[model samples]
Target: MDLLIDSFVSAILLVVSLDAEMIAIVGVSIKVSLTSTLFASIIGIPLGFAIAFGDAPGKRWMITILNTLLALPTVVIGLFVYTFISRRGVFGPFDLLYTQRAIIIGQLILIIPVVTAFTISAISRIDERYRKTAMTLGADRIQTAWVVFREARFGIGAAVIAAFGRVISEVGISMMLGGNIRGFTRTMTTAMALEYDKGSFTLAIALGLVLLSFSFGMNMLFHFFQGRSRL
Candidate 1:
């Protein structure tokens, strides 16, 4: 108990001191997570909207596959990306393995499914009457999709937040794809894992505090959107 208390106190001091290494890791984490989330959102949102509104053959199967991919294991994603980027693989000439880009790619894969699945669910919940009304008013397919998306904006925002939350906290992809190289691809979750293995709890605790704050902020934003939707 005393050790734990001491670790917590040290963590507070470290954060207060703005420890350079800690700050760097946190910055890298934020940059990678935000970049990957942005990319995932750009790709996933449109795909979600398409799947939600389009009547193409095998659409149901595609959605089911996407839903299943939403639960894909992080380690599996790491391994898959690792194989593609490794020396023996086709893209190996570029040497993307064990870099920030590698980590971002792994994280993007991890979160895309999250963003897509949530987006689909959000669009699915919009009232069918709204769609029928829009079509009746001469709104073409594109306009109808826009109307549904506008109505479902808050829910879509929630999906984005959820994707960010998942990728920011994940360790497997970061560790495997990034090699957790200090001063390079190291991130909060990976740093915490390394520190824990080294029995250095101070940095881990500090990063955990930051992660907790991020999660709280996301939840608060989600609630704000939820409240607005209700209003």
Candidate 2:
């Protein structure tokens, strides 16, 4: 259709021009996603390793809960976090609502389960003999854990990549918690949503193209690491 073609061309021009608003939205998206992913990895990776290697009772239940949370809706996470941070809510005194920190918190919650589940799966797939072998070689508990983590590094990396993908493209948490304030909290996803709602498809299409390209690159890296893991 002519409209589609025009929109596509306009989007390309917008991207090529590095429009200020577009750049700002993209920057915010990357900042929030990377921050949340880092926090999620910091907490989730260790939690996964602990659950996988430790003899904690009811670990099955813990893992089951985490796995179940992988399917949790983004809006649900946004709503849950908003409840605590919003005015008149439990932690309302902190005034976290509608801020980058609030968006990060929601996104952190969203990706924690993803990273933890993937990490657990990754570590669980490693041969049990590795642990026994490490112990036989006089590796202490800490050293053995380190060895296990090294063996599963690729999978853990994949988990991180996946978490990045999820948080970067998600709109609900960013919109709900960040309030989509232009030049402040607005991100690519939220901007795209706003543009689409306003029937301004050019910018939305541009953001989509950028987001898709980014996700594709991440997937390629994920597959590369996954393939390398087998070697």
* Candidate closest to the true structure, highest lDDT: 2
Best candidate, TM-score? 2
In model 1, the Cα lDDT at residue 20 comes to 98
Error of 1 at 108 (Å): 1.2
Estimated TM-score for each candidate: 0.95, 0.98
List candidate 2 stretches off by more than 4 Å: none
Q: lDDT per model, in order?
A: 0.91, 0.94
**Candidate 1 residue-wise lDDT, 128-149, digit = tens:** 9989999999999889888999
* Residue-level lDDT tens digits of model 2 in 88-110: 88999998998999999999999
Write out the backbone clash pairs for model 1.
Answer: none
